[model samples]
Target: MATLLFVLHVLGAVVWVGGMAFALLVLRPAAHEALEPPQRLALMDGVFRRFFRILWHVVPIVVLTGWAMWLGWYWGFGASIWHVHLMHLTGLVMAAIFGLVALGPGRAMRAALAAGDRPGAATALDRIRKGVSVNLALGLLTVAVAAWGRFGG
Candidate 1:
């Protein structure tokens, strides 16, 4: 079960980080070069729509499995303070950031796409861009903590 939880945790990290990489590095540049603003915004809408579907499943499992892993390692609390604190704090912060993404940029992105407002879509995309950027950074930090702090002393 612990191994399984670690696998789930890694998979969730991949989805969130990989999605960001695709969006920021691959899709954004390719769209900008290949299309105009209207088409670019439309493409982002479609891409995020597809991506967010998987996120709905991924993020929750990350949290659930994360909790299980931490609680399962109750014995490890004595192993290292950094190990436990890193897990707990990063999970809490990640959850809060996910909530913001859902409520703020996610809502606006859908609304802008529905209204077919190119400029509005751009604005909404900007918000999502910022939010995703933050998420990406936080996700990286979580990864680092998991690796370096796992057996911290």
Candidate 2:
């Protein structure tokens, strides 16, 4: 169960984290080269639609597996201070990003798309791009600290 839980946790994280990295790095470059204004806007709409749909599934898995790990730890040793801190901080940041996407940029993007405003969509995309870039950096930092936290203690 522990191994399975660990695998699920890591895999879920990789999908979410890796996807963001790819979007920030590889996909953005390719999209820039291969697409023009209308195409770029439409392509981005499709990209967000698909990626965020997957994120809806991935987020729950991450929460479930993460909680499961914490529960396992709780049963084993009562509580661990470092894990708690890491979990809390990472969870807060993740929730913030999710909120931004769900309530902020997500709404803006959909509104722009629905209104068929390319400039509006572009503006919304700029906001999302910046937000996701921040999120990606934070997520990577979280992963690194989580992996190496024992050393800090």
Candidate 3:
């Protein structure tokens, strides 16, 4: 059970982080270079729709498995190591950012697109891009902390 949970947790993290990396590094650049605003916005809307859909599933697995491991098997918050606390803190922050993106800019983007408001959609997408960049940096930092913390102690 623990092994399965661990696998699921790791997979969830990989999918979420990897998807962000691909979007920020690859897709966003290609879209900007190859497409005009209307096409780019549409492409981004579709891309985020698919990616965020995957995230809805991944978030629960990651959060549940993480809490299970932390509170069920490993030491709870008070007894856990610094690394675990840091990971949890960062993870929660990432989740909150995701929520903001989904609920705030994401919704706005969709509504704007539906209303045929390209400028509005573009603004929303810009906000999402900034937010995702921050999340990606945090995610990478969390991974580094996880790896280094294991060996440090």
Candidate 4:
């Protein structure tokens, strides 16, 4: 049970963090270079739609499985190490950020695209990029904490 939970937790993190990394690092650059605003924006909108849909499922799995391991296997918050607490805090923050991006800019982009408001869509995409940048940095930090925390004590 513990192994299963851990596996699920890690997979969730990988999918979320890795997806962000790919979008910000790889896809954004290539798309910007190859496409005009309308095409680029449309491509991003489609990409985000698919990715965010996957995230809806991944976020819960990550959070729930992490909590399950922390509470059920590691004997809960009080018994866990400092890093465990940090990881939980960071995870929740990431989740909240994800929700904000999805609800706020995600919707804005879609609506703007539908209305043929390219500038509005571009603005929304910029906001989403900034949000993802922050989350990606935090996610990397959390991963560092998790991987190295085991050796700290």
Candidate 5:
């Protein structure tokens, strides 16, 4: 059971973090270079819609499996190692950022697009871009801490 939970947890993390990396590094730049504002915004709208939909499922799984490992398979929360605590903290931060993107800018973008307000959509997309960038950095830091902190402590 623990092994299965670990696998699910890792998969969830990979999907969420890897998707953010691809959006920030590859898709965003490519769209900016190749597409006009309207097209770019449309593309981003579609991309984020799909990605966030998947995230709705992935985030809960990641959280549940992580807690299962920390509180069930190994030590309870209070007894967890520093790395575990760091990972949990960063993960929650990422989730909070995601929540803001999904609820605030994300909905605004959709509404702006539907109403044919390109500039408003752009502003919302900018907000999402910044949020995703921060989350990506935190995700990478969490991964590093999870890997190296195990040995450091």
Candidate 6:
């Protein structure tokens, strides 16, 4: 059961963080070079729609499995090492940032694109990019904490 929970937790983080990394690093640059504003915005809209849908489910799984590991497997709260606490803190903050992007700029981008407001969509996408950038950095940091902090200590 613990193994299963750990696997799920890691998978959830991989999907979210990996997806962000690819979208930000690879996809964004390729799309910018290959497409114009209208096409680029449209592509981003579609990509975000699909990604956000997946994340809606993934986020909960990640949170639940993480909690199960910390509270159930690790002997519940305050009993684990500092790395675990850092992971929990960063994970929650990342989740909140995802929520902000999905609810705020995400919706705006969709609405703006639907109404043919390219500039508005661009603005929203820019905001989303910034949020994703921050989250990606945090995700990498959390990953490092989870990986090295265990053995380094």
Candidate 6 lDDT, tens digit per residue, 98-146? Answer: 9999999999999998898999999999999999999999999999999
Give the C-alpha lDDT of model 6.
0.95
Tens-place lDDT per residue, model 4, 52-90, is 999999999999999999999879989998889999999
What are the per-residue Cα lDDT tens digits for candidate 2 across 105-151?
Answer: 76788788899887898988888788778878877977887777746
Q: What shift in Å separates residue 127 of candidate 5 from its native position after superposition? A: 0.1
Model 1 segments beyond 4 Å from truth? Answer: 76-80, 151-153
- RMSD for each model, in Å, please? 2.2, 2.3, 0.9, 0.7, 0.9, 0.7
Q: Which stretches of candidate 6 lie over 4 Å from their true place?
A: none
Report residue 123 deviation for candidate 2 (angstroms).
1.1
CA lDDT, candidate 4, residue 34: 100
Which candidate has the highest lDDT of all? 4
Each prediction's whole-model lDDT (CA): 0.78, 0.79, 0.92, 0.96, 0.94, 0.95
Off by over 4 Å in 3: none
Candidate 3, lDDT over the whole model: 0.92
Q: What's the lDDT for candidate 2?
A: 0.79
The C-alpha local distance difference test score for the whole of candidate 1 amounts to: 0.78
The better candidate by lDDT, 1 or 2, is 2
Give the candidate order by descending lDDT: 4, 6, 5, 3, 2, 1
Q: What's the lDDT for residue 22 in model 3?
A: 99
lDDT of 1 by residue, 1-153 (tens): 789888988888788778887888888989999998887887888887778777878888988777777667554445445655676677678767767876787778789878876677688788888877787787778777777865554
Model 2: colliding residue pairs: none
Question: Which of the two, 2 or 5, has more lDDT?
Answer: 5
